[model samples]
Target: MRFSVPLAALLGAGLSEAQYLISEMSFGYAGRISSADNPGVIPNFVVSGQPTKPEILSSKVILTPVAPGNARGAIWSEQPLKHPNFIVDVDFRASGPDRAGGNFNIWLANHGKDIGAKSVYSAGRFEGLVLVVDSHGGQGGMLRGFLNDGSVDYSQHHSVDQLAFGHCQYSYRNLGRPSQIKMRQTSTSFRVQIDGKTCFETDRVSLPTGYDVGVTASTPDNPDSFEIFKLVVMSDTSSHDASSNSGDNNNNNNNNNNNNNNNNGNSNNGNSNGGSNMLYKKQSSSGDESFVDLADEEADVFQTSKSQFQDLHNRLQGTNHQLSSVYRSVSRHHQMDEQRHNEIKDLLAALQSKVELLDEISSFRQRIVALENEVRNMNNELHKKLQDNERSVQGALRVHHNSLTQRVAESVPGHGKLIAVIIGTQVILVVGYVLYKRRRANSPKKYL
Candidate 1:
């Protein structure tokens, strides 16, 4: 568990963990592909970036579109890398229609056992780097790797979700338009940049080093061309200050921290043997010397994710408010309708009362007319009797007058009673009809 490792091995392993992998295809370095000696050919390439039969002029990588108008290319590493942290960067100039591929044309394949179309990615055996481009703008890029698996030895695979650590504008119009791209890895964070501008940064990425670095390019409708300017690799050693002679103290601290953390993490996995397949530590050690936006990247990622979450929360709140307003408005309208219905019922009652009054007045008028007619008839009978006989005419007149008066009196009372009954009946019928109508209107029945 406490075995010492050579300085060189430690450096290589550490370099894999701390280096920044940058690729700027700007036709620089004699248009030679990064890490490849050939001018146009991309090494470890599953797909060709340039034509198999290329046209090289003045060290420029010229590409001529084939039929159907799409160009595809890829470049992979000759050997696998085994570091736990690192960065990657790539730049390309694209023209015509550019469509993203199933997998990122720009990616880091880690712990990949074989190279071909069909390859099995073992648990904890792979990590991916991605940059997606479309006509709209740059899409978010991602890095993926696994932790544990069941088939190998563990009970289950601790699957990781696709986290958006960084985003860069990868549009067809922006490619090769004087841009610098970079991916940097530190002890506990990852940073990405484009054109010296920080794009993606995250502290959640935990990947092992010794991954095959590769580039794959694809365009769908039209042939896409990329211009690569430079590819540089460097290690991260910012933790150390060469001016200070406290190298001994730094070395001791670095070793102790590295060993302690590794052992503790392993022991928690139910494996008693902590240093058998553990990481090697060395004397006179130093951290990786890779360069990236360390401070800015961490801050940037935190802000971006925070902003996105806030935006979604605001939208939800707005929607709830809108729904609440609609409900309140509907409730108010319903109450108003109920009040109007009540007013209509009161008006109908008043109308029925007035109708009953008019009927009573009509009956009273008819009775008065009948009484007048009886009085006139009695006077005419008395006058006829007086003309027929002179003798006792006054007495006859008196009797006739009395008889008429009594008849008038009797008729008046009878007429009044009859009129009152008829008026009462009509009033009752009218009130009953109005009440029945109001009840029916309030019930759940069709108005028509």
Candidate 2:
């Protein structure tokens, strides 16, 4: 038993460091030996054949293995654990599975108390891992998590028609498995793994702490036979044991005494109204089923409301997504427009440059044409002036020669040479003026 509380003092000392408190501990298993040669510790308790008041039958737990190869068992406890965060390990060996009492091997319940007829609670459910194994046929085992409240958060179950086991095949199931199951009060998450394989995990658990923890088994109409090997429960002690259990025994004795007195009073009233009263009590007991039904109905309403809320939330999210897409599209369009504008600007700049070049070319061509016309006109004018000057020079020379012949007769014949020189000077002046005008007209417009 102490082994089940492994490192309790150490754990207490480490609580502050770990930020958790531990409270109660327990283990469960069926008392059975595989072979007389191999004597092992098995804990079992007897229960009535029928469900009278639905009580629990549990035996003293052994924390250690009985033999060298003896396997372990599963265990659980009522809240509050020693710490807010607690870990429970189950080392169990299951064999000769049968169908009885729903064939549920392991279960956990919280926040519950026994009413006169049936248990009642704000909320409580049996939850655990289901194994799928068949040694007889070749069927394998599966691990499932379920809730007694008809609520399923996580599950692992094999097909019902699957074979259990077959010849030449080892047990097609995970058995004699050692697993560490942990629950932290702060979080509703619980996880289980066998060996190194994850068997089950869930976060939908919302059971309250500081509540009764119990384990139960049933002999089903199917009558399945299975055994729990070992169990270990570690919880927050500071919280789980909020009240001092110092005088719990004394208090229980007192309560029992009071109950006896109440029973006596009930017996005295058991006269003519006894049968009628009993019928009324039965009817009231059936009302317990209605409690479950009411809970189910309320749960249905809550689920419907939740689904509607979720649907609306999803619609809003979709709208937001569409809006975001539209924003991005607009941004892209703006960017493209800017790029096109830049391209147009570049094209305009190039066109302007080409236009300036064309203008310059046109001016150059016009200058060339003007220069050619001016040169032709200057040549014609020069030729005409030359002919006129030649005529004038000839006339002057003839007059002067006649005057010089007269003078020579009277004075000297060399006077005629002077007249010829004057005529040549006039011709040279006219030619120079004509050549200057032609050069001015032929010059480039740029220079002008």
Candidate 3:
């Protein structure tokens, strides 16, 4: 009896069919990479612009530092992706001032001419796809896709926004966490996802083999930081292999014709099912030959499991590194919060001291008011006593004057003159005493 095991069953048995990983096919795009993490090995992407490449720790790479001025941030894959149908997962973060015009780009295209005249990220005559996540002044992330076939100069192109085929806006900046950008390319269509949710897809988009990957960032005068924690590219090559084998010559002709197409002509007008998240159509199996190909590729289940375990280990290690980073971030934020709390505490203490000083000032004012009231009472009493004394003296003088007048009438006129002199002297003494009391009451007094 002939052994008839279905390829689907083999896949179910953990034997991945024609799908290749990145590391497994690095040379000439044949790497069947199972994972992106290599404990000590640097990643396969070369950083652009910077002559000195940074070490890839835990698959994280820094494209540019957050600084003012329109600094270019870019990174390119070392190998050109040969698989036509592939999936790319990009985890990144962009942060800066609220008004920072921060943005980063994901590009897929053939090798471009190396020159500063062209964005250090792309070539002067480049052909491929670009997905731009722009932070519209920190309002949110504007996801826009562009298809270019290198005829026009992108450097001087003013109205690139008009060339966008599909776009969606979402808040993906300053999230305190990373946002994922997922892109899938198939023979018939291309698709993009943000945070596992499909944003847009286009059937009109077609990418040939031998396309490389790249990322770039840009910021305004108020610089924004764009960081990439991970970039994982994987592929489902069964359909691509089938199509490539069907007609080698036809594909070459198509590639040439498509390459010559204008970049602006790529419009997803009705080609994309916006917000639908529908998957692309897969190529149907051509018959018994598919089984034969799958049969020839059969391998030991034990080795497959062993390879999977290693990939799992690598993934765990990478996860540990990411966790460590998150821990550090959390710790830093905690420190900042503690510092802010202490500052607030100090401010409160100062405010309390100020309140106490104001209370003392208010008490002092009340005491001064009380003293002024007491002095006014004393002056009033003194004035009353002086009034009483003046009344008694006036009575006595009146009585004495009457007596003198009577005596003068009864005795002599000379006695009358003497009584008048005595009355004048008493009036002068009373006037002097009243003036002295008024001067003492009006003068300033120091109680303390």
Q: Rank by lDDT, highest first.
A: 3, 1, 2
Candidate 3 residue lDDT tens string, 187-233: 77889999988899999988887777777776667867777776767
Superposition error at 187 for model 2 (Å): 2.7
Clashing pairs in 3: 20-32, 21-32, 21-33, 22-33, 24-31, 24-32, 25-30, 25-31, 25-32
Could you tell me the TM-score of candidate 2? 0.29
TM-score of 1: 0.36
Least lDDT summed over 10 consecutive residues: which range in candidate 3? 287-296
How much is the lDDT of residue 354 in candidate 3? 63
The lDDT values for all models are 0.46, 0.40, 0.61
Q: Tens-digit lDDT track for model 2 on 1-448?
A: 1212433444444433332223234444223222244323222312221233121224332222222222222233433333434555454333333321122233344432221111111122223222222233424444434344435322223332232111122232234443333333335666655554555555755444444333333332333233444455554332312342323334435544654554455456433212211111111221110111111122243244444454344345335544643464465446545654664565556555666777788899999999999999999999999999999999999999999989878874576788888988888899999999999999877853
User: Measured by TM-score, how close is model 3 to the native structure?
Assistant: 0.45
Tens digit of lDDT per residue, candidate 1, span 143-185? 3222332233211334223323344454334343644567777
Model 2 whole-model lDDT (C-alpha atoms): 0.40
* Better lDDT candidate (2, 3): 3
